[model samples]
Target: MLLGAERGAGCYAARVLAKRIIPCLDVHNGRTTRGQQFGRAEHGELRDVGDPVALALRYDEGGADELVFYDITATAEGRGAMLDIITQVAERCFMPLTVGGGVRTLADFRALFLAGADKVSINSGAVANPEVVRAAAEHYGSQAVVFSIDAKKRPDASGWEVYVAGGRKATGLDLLEWAVRGQELGAGEIVLNSIDADGMKTGYDLEATRAVARAVDIPVIASGGAGNALHMRDVLLYGEADAALAAGIFHSGQTTVGEVKRLLAAAGVHVRLVQHATLGW
Candidate 1:
């Protein structure tokens, strides 16, 4: 559990921050992928978008607030994320880069940072060994640690449960409780991925997002179920998420990061819009 000194401090400090538009690259075996839920499109499938380096370059030109790369199968396969991709992306992207999947120790965080990752995200590792969260924060600052949580609604309609190992196992932990504990444990931010909303295109599970956001003091990034820009607006405003992460909508060419940011701006949300470097401001 987080101490009283840590509780809600991060959240309060971030209350006035601009809402971020993040593009997520779900990589499998070195290729970017998109699927309806957590399912990965097979190697030859058209859903295997292309090289992550190319996609990162595109998003960088499009004015994305940040880039997130998740090695979708790393934890399940018991290996680390490909460092070559992170190195390539860091060299090309000017914005912050967050890498996740298969992060299990301080060494993992060290390797990711040394390889050009601005931040490291840990899900299963944090759940399995909560001490790693503290260790990472101690080694690096808490600001460099992002704790990702995969959550699903309970069968009894009670609350959400934490899922780990690429959403394959349940931890029987309450979503709200885990988020609070994560903040207490020194995580700088939280990425709340909704299993129920994964690939649904029905918009985010605002109920789950709001519940977790209210429970913690850190920034909460809403992930999954984003079919369009309206969904991103809803999550940032009503759901109270500090950032919105989308994979399918952007990967499938259904939407662009600029489109999402523009829509949110029109809807009265504060976001970083890149004015034309072509024209003097």
Candidate 2:
């Protein structure tokens, strides 16, 4: 049971476990990159930020609860994630690491675990073969598997639709139904990335997030459109997410994990605060 309150009726409440703030690294060709709403970079150059390993170290020291690395182009290119980078980041960053992209089989899960990933995220692969989620969970324990859903709002404004292959292909599956199915298949957690809200920085698609959180039993991590600490707070509290994952805001030096934590803590939300000696803010 989490540290705070229990889930009640319409009023969404907090769980005692401190909400996690994760910094996402979307890697392409072994380099970290960021684009608006998953767009291609200007010209032929990727938006190279810094070395993934180096950035992981900074975030780890700076007090990120966990790190999520996505080999953004792996699925599109029909290749696996760059294991070398995963291994390097795993070796250096002490916090929990979740590695995604190209996790198509139980073997891929084993390989990532052996490479030091604490959790393996499955997106397209799981959509293509739902049993893979069950098989991995049975073999590696549910805690080791995270079902990642990239969802976009439907054309008729009915509900969210699932997208795969890095948000390029639509699965035509209902978002709430898929999340419940993932939970039934033994996924330990759900990562809901709203394609409509991604990179928009307007706010999280609270409607979609709240719906999935209410539908599933597992913890939900809301990804995309995190502009500031307020957005993080809203997702965790009102949106009912267990954690909030953001890329551009953290990658562009707009905010730090510690800063977000302090704000969350001050807002009467449970969050781990990093020692001031390191943050200096």
> Any idea what lDDT model 1 has?
0.85
Over 1-281, each residue of candidate 2 has an lDDT whose tens digit, in order, gives 21101111111222226788999998987788876666654345357887888889989999988889999878888898778887787767667788999989988887887777878899999999999999988877777789999999988999999999988899989999999999999988899998888888998988899999999888899998898879999999989999999988887889889889888988898877767477885
lDDT of 1 by residue, 209-265 (tens): 998989998899999999899999999999999999998888778888887888888
Q: Please state the error at residue 267 of candidate 2 in Å.
A: 0.4
**TM-score: model 2 vs. ground truth:** 0.91
lDDT of 2 at 2: 16
For model 2, where is the 10-residue window of minimal lDDT?
2-11
lDDT of 2 at 56: 92
Give the candidate number with the greatest lDDT: 1
RMSD per candidate (Å) reads 5.1, 5.9
- The Cα local distance difference test for each model comes to 0.85, 0.84
